[model samples]
Target: MSDKVFNKKIFAYIVAVVLSVFCFLPCLCLVEAEEQPSEAPTVYAADVSVTQGSGTYIYVYAKNFADVSGLDLFVRYDTSAFTLGRATKGSFISSALCDVNAETAGEIRLSYVSVDGVSGDGLILTVLLYSESEAEIKDYKVDIIVGDCYDSGLNSVAVSASGCKITVKEKQQITETVTFYSRYEDVTKRKGDEVALSFYTYNSHGFASADFEINFDDEMLALKSVSLGESLKNTDSATFSVNDKTDGYVKISYAALSAAPSYVTVLEISFTVIGDKDGQTQIEFISSALYNSDLTAYNGSKSIVTVNTEEIPSVIVYPKISLKAHSVTYSEVELDIFAEKDTLLAAGDFFVEFNAEEYECVDIVKIFDGSMIVGNTAFKAGMARLSFIYEDGISGDTAIARLRFKVLAPCETKSEFSISGSKITDKDFNEQIVEYVGTTIVVPHDFSNEFTTDEQPTCDTSGSKSHHCSRCAAVKDVTEIDALGHEYIHHEAKAPTCVEIGWKAYDTCSRCNYTTYEEIKAKGHTKAVAVEENRIEATCLEKGQYDSVVYCSVCNEELSREKKIIEALGHDYIHHKAKAPTCVEIGWEAYDTCSRCDYTTYKEISEKGHTKAAAVEENKIEATCLEDGHYDSVIYCSVCNEELSREEKTIEALGHEYGEWIVDLEPTVSAEGREYRKCLRCEHREERSVEKLKNDDEELSGCFGTLDLTSIVMIVAIMLICGVFVKVKSRKSNR
Candidate 1:
């Protein structure tokens, strides 16, 4: 072969070897030119969620050839009903677009010049990408229900890049439905117990509500709760409660499972109750569907129910002891009984009997059993197992049940009075007493034939003028004029003719006049009515004996000051009813009454001060002032700049002299207690400006300015590692 032919053949072989090496390099793999794209960029906002007062930024990134420049940002958010804006840089400037929920809507855009060194973006050709979707909702805490008509998979979000995340930024709230919880109180309740039941019908928008009757059957035996929720999302729960008066069943039927406000979708929820004797004493829950379209509800939409109950029993009592009163009429006896369960219950009755161990006498007396409401009967006298029976309102089924109570003897009280007599000459006493003015005599007994005595009597016997001091000093036989013509003294008063000078017949008295109790007894008068100590001559004539009025010297009218009695005058007793109201009444039939007391009342002396005592003479009051200031606090009489003088002087006023001001007392403590009147005195204390205190504020304990060089270096290191990892992952994914 010739030299030229050999050279051409070798070159062709070399070309083939070079192509094989290039293919093995991996970085120079050939790609189709048709796949290279170049068009004006766009930013598509998938969707988003943000709360008012919160801030977050979204990025729309695009890659281009080395000569290509930046792509600006813009947005349209009025559900596409918004206008677009010219390009601007991709950056935040305040709580603006970055704060997705910044209260400004329509569209959001990130724009910039092809900003290589802030200059290249002027070229204007663009490239674009998209951010997640946008949702601007107020109150961040709103319970939300988002119905997506465009797409379906929010239940589990997927991002374009790893580590990029999406969250339910704001909660959706249901305005149409108001939910609540229910609970059972009985220990017999179990985890799946249908302890109560009721029914409710809801409207299409979840508003109008009406409770109906519960219809029970065999299938839904353990009905936890009737609820509504989304099909895929595992949302929170709704609650329910029971007051026990529930029927054996319930029915829940609504126009639809969920309501419509912005969009319509099905709502779902599950109910869970853990009891089996484990439960909550009270319930806390969100409200359920109640009001109708106009926010109105049915009559019984909200109601309370109560359960009927049975009671336990009382078996036996001990302390086998007895007590005979000092008078055998009253005393106390104690007895014991056994019971189970720490329960509180209603009022009840017991029947008990007592017969003396040896002397079984049937005398009426009261019996007590430590129960204040428990009544005691009157006991004549006796012993022998003061047996009584009682019932308890709290019973048990799975346990042995018993309760305890005690019995006690009771007593009745009676007030006693002793009769007595008094003596003095009414006219004679008046004549002999100037110091005795305004004072009168009081005794415990009454005397008759008091006006018959013409002479003073002694304790011993005297003639008709001289006397046997018993009923009267002396008495006349007015019976001589009677049809029987017998000599017996008559009970009559003497009428004075012309009111001639003093006749010496004076009888009933303890301190002012004289009277024998025997004579008072004969006239059939009680001691209380006849004798009172302070006799006011004015009103005494009306009451006969003065107990309440004071002697009035001017008008001669009775000066009636209030009288002291156990109860108020005209209001010492009251009457009342005994039975409690039942379901038959509209809530309350037993209001407060005092008919049995037989009177209305006034505040007792203890309750109202100054009820009787008169005011004393007033004194002239004075004052002194002093300064009270602290080291740290600043104070000023903002109105009057006048410096106050601090001194203390005792001024007598309102009938009394208040004490002086003591400087030694702690001013801080004193200032807290006394409300100082800002008068001509305290005007000094100056106040400092708040602006001056601002300088004392603390500075943030952090490094400011761009991140430290060290941090930047670390970030760069992390980015490098992540980029390598991503590249490897990409290769694997492609493979």
Candidate 2:
């Protein structure tokens, strides 16, 4: 073979071995890489926005997470703009236990955990933010801070912080105005009289149309008609509508072709005074609306007109007198003389007459605003007269005089002051006609007969009372008051017991034979006693009992006798007297007995006492380097056939007994030294070292040393090749 070919083959084998080793190195490195720990997850905040009075939320996001257990998220925001509400867990942590503290004004914190770990990306928690009413219309900032965050492994999670911006907007607003009024100050009319009221309005902006609703006391006045006022009626194209279908209220609407004047009468309403009793009622404009030409709203004002019934006299011209009548028992009656109108009254004379048997005129005087009067009053029997003259005539309506009368006795009669007979003249000395309305006066007479009693009648007794005249000291009548029956109070009966007697309780009236009670009976004996002394003692192996008796505590009688068994205690053996078996001697028998019954028992004991004789070897053998030696030994009991001890003994090892060392293999120049020896009996061999000739010639040595196995084989193959080559050459020459 060619040398080049052989070298190529060797190079190929080297490359293969190097490649194989290189391949294994990468696999080992990969295993090491796989064993390295993973990085922790990150948590962060997300931005959000909300309007004033609107609700929104912010998110706490977790990224690159794995097996997360719990985390505390702390976030801060502008307290002036935002309010924290409920916090909700994200899907990643939805099933975990959670706690939220958003109650603090601007800060919110949440924590969540799960027994089963949470992992992956997504939100960890979401918190709600509500814009408060006082929140300003501007931007708000929410910032996040790192808190306690952990994974299922209890390792803290790394987190990055970010802030969110919230925008707030203002709310909307609205404003409006309308009004109504009456043309008259107040109207006065008699019952069954009709009156009219005109409603007007004043608006800054001229109005094209107007609508109004007016309400009045339905019991006092009934709406008769409603019509457009003259101001609105002049508009030829104007329209008017009225709704009087509902009692107590009239709704009217007026529209013009163009905007009406700023101040104009919008409606005329007529009503009839229907009720009989005299009263004043309000004609109120409850609601009103004025519209511009384009139908846009315009502001206005509202007003009310008071309507009074004429049954109440007017304070203008007529003079009126009022006398107040009281109970017949009243000591005196007063007459208040007043004028319905303000007038110049120079002089006036008044006279009042009452029943002579019931009352008498006691006094006459002028009351309030009487400084202008110089009067002399006279009263006698049942007639009273008063006259006055004013230095400067009276100008306004006022009380002229006050007359008082004394009650003479108890009587029912009518009395009055007559202005027809009296005289009233003005400063011009002209007579003034006065309208005087009179009232009946009654004076009650004192009664001698009166009912008197000390105590009121009750359900259980009759009470007596007397009727007599206290003033006349006359007994007009005497009678008795009926009695009321007694009301008995009772208690439920109690049941009888072994020692206590039972009874029922009740009450009885003192004035009447109304009695209530309950029966009581003697109680029986309650028995109790100590344990009986007739009980038999229990044996260790058997159970026994005796009758126990109980006696009554109150009667000293036997109540019950019952059997109570005593439990048996097992036998007790004495440990100190126990006999143990020995190697040669026989032990005494063991026995047990009950402590209470004295019953005995016995048990067989094995013999254990024994003494051992000295050991004697029976079989013995010699030992060699390769084989073990042995001997048998035993110790016998001195008093029995039992062997106390036995053993198989070893005679100690006879290690290799080698002869003198001799050279086993002669060392070559490149080889190490070697020598050996053998055991005489076992033929076991041992070796020793011998020195080798050192190699000084470099040309003679192979790669490792002088001709190692591989080099030597290669050299022998070369020699064979050289011989084959010579043979081939010879063969060729012969050819």
Residue 691 lDDT in model 1?
18
Error of 2 at 277 (Å): 27
Candidate 2 all-Cα RMSD: 45.8
What overall lDDT goes with each candidate model?
0.29, 0.67
All candidates' TM-scores? 0.15, 0.28
Candidate 2 residues 1-735, lDDT tens each? 565675566556556654655566566557757876675566676556564555666777877767778777787888677666445556666678987677776777777777787778887666667688668888777777768777777887775666677777774331456556677746568888887878766753667776676767666888888887787777657888888754466777877778766687777888888876666778777443567778776544457788777574545646555454422354667766665554456677666666676666665666655454433344555566667777566787767777666765544445544432356777788887766666766543344455776357887567767655434444434566677666555566776556667777667765566766666676787756655857877776777788888887766667777888888766765433667666755566656665555566666666667677888886789887867899989888786757878899998878888888888788987687788898988888888777777676754564456443444444655565566557656755776
Please provide, for model 1 over 540-562, each residue's C-alpha lDDT reduced to its tens digit, 9 standing for 90 to 100: 11222335545333223343444
Highest lDDT: which candidate?
A: 2
Worst 10-residue lDDT window for candidate 1 reads 431-440
